[model samples]
Target: MTLGFGEGRAFGYAGCNRYFSGYTLRGNRLDLGTPGSTKRYCEGEGGEVERAFLPLLAHPFILQREGEHMRLIASDGTRLEFEAAAMESRYP
Candidate 1:
């Protein structure tokens, strides 16, 4: 799948949360700004956890790939891993 620039794009969830992040290859850092969370007040079991997690993404990240797994290692020793696979999308 084409991940595009992996930054400077608006990514959203169905719950209405949007994130704005940027990538800088020079310092090998992916930075996210003040990410605005969804305020529609749709509280679910995981709503509080999701809201808390989104704001914690303000730190920088370093992307590492191992096979199909893309790991976003943050500066604080936190790693967000995403598995890359062929999904049915417009590009496919």
Candidate 2:
């Protein structure tokens, strides 16, 4: 999975599909609006991950960052960790 933030929006490739949503961040609290994604069918692990991951966006999460590592902590204490990807010029 990959995530990027810019201009009040959060977008990423969510294992099986690309997703985007508006976001508001104040201090360590991050709130994501209803997300929108492409309708694509995927099987196996990607599909399973998508199912488990997307719903987490519905609730606010606490963001933690240390160097190149970042983590999103859900209200239920589920922690999603991510490492910074190399910046590419492909995205605008």
Candidate 3:
């Protein structure tokens, strides 16, 4: 299953590692594509998490939005956790 977040809703991770994939609905499933990222890396705190973060987003995530958080879980047991920010978003 996929997710539908709607238009004008920009998505990114905790540390401003943003993505350019727009959200759309195809029937009951949401289609996500065109994921682009910046080559820069953060070397400080949560860096390992950051390192783990990007590579884990290899495929389009099946998403679900909660009251405040968006939970993204993959089939490989890799879970990407992003706190819901009023100005930011994340998915795996």
Could you say which candidate leads in TM-score?
2
| Model 3 spans > 4 angstroms off | 1-10, 14-16, 22-34, 88-92
Off by over 4 Å in 1: 1-7, 14-16, 22-27, 85-92
List the candidates' TM-scores in order: 0.60, 0.90, 0.53
Candidate 3: C-alpha lDDT? 0.51
* Candidates in order: C-alpha RMSD to true structure: 5.1, 2.1, 5.6
Tell me the whole-model lDDT of each prediction, alpha carbons only. 0.53, 0.85, 0.51
- Model 2 over residues 1-92: C-alpha lDDT tens digits? 77788767888877898888889999999999878888799899999998888988889999999999999999999998989996322222
Clash count, one per candidate:
0, 0, 0
Q: Residue 92 of model 2: what lDDT?
A: 24
TM-score attained by model 2: 0.90
Model 1 lDDT at residue 35: 57
* lDDT for each residue of candidate 1 in 1-92, tens digit (9 for 90 to 100): 11323334423342334334443554556665545544556477456656656765677778787898777787778877667655323210
Span of 10 residues, lowest total lDDT, candidate 2: 83-92
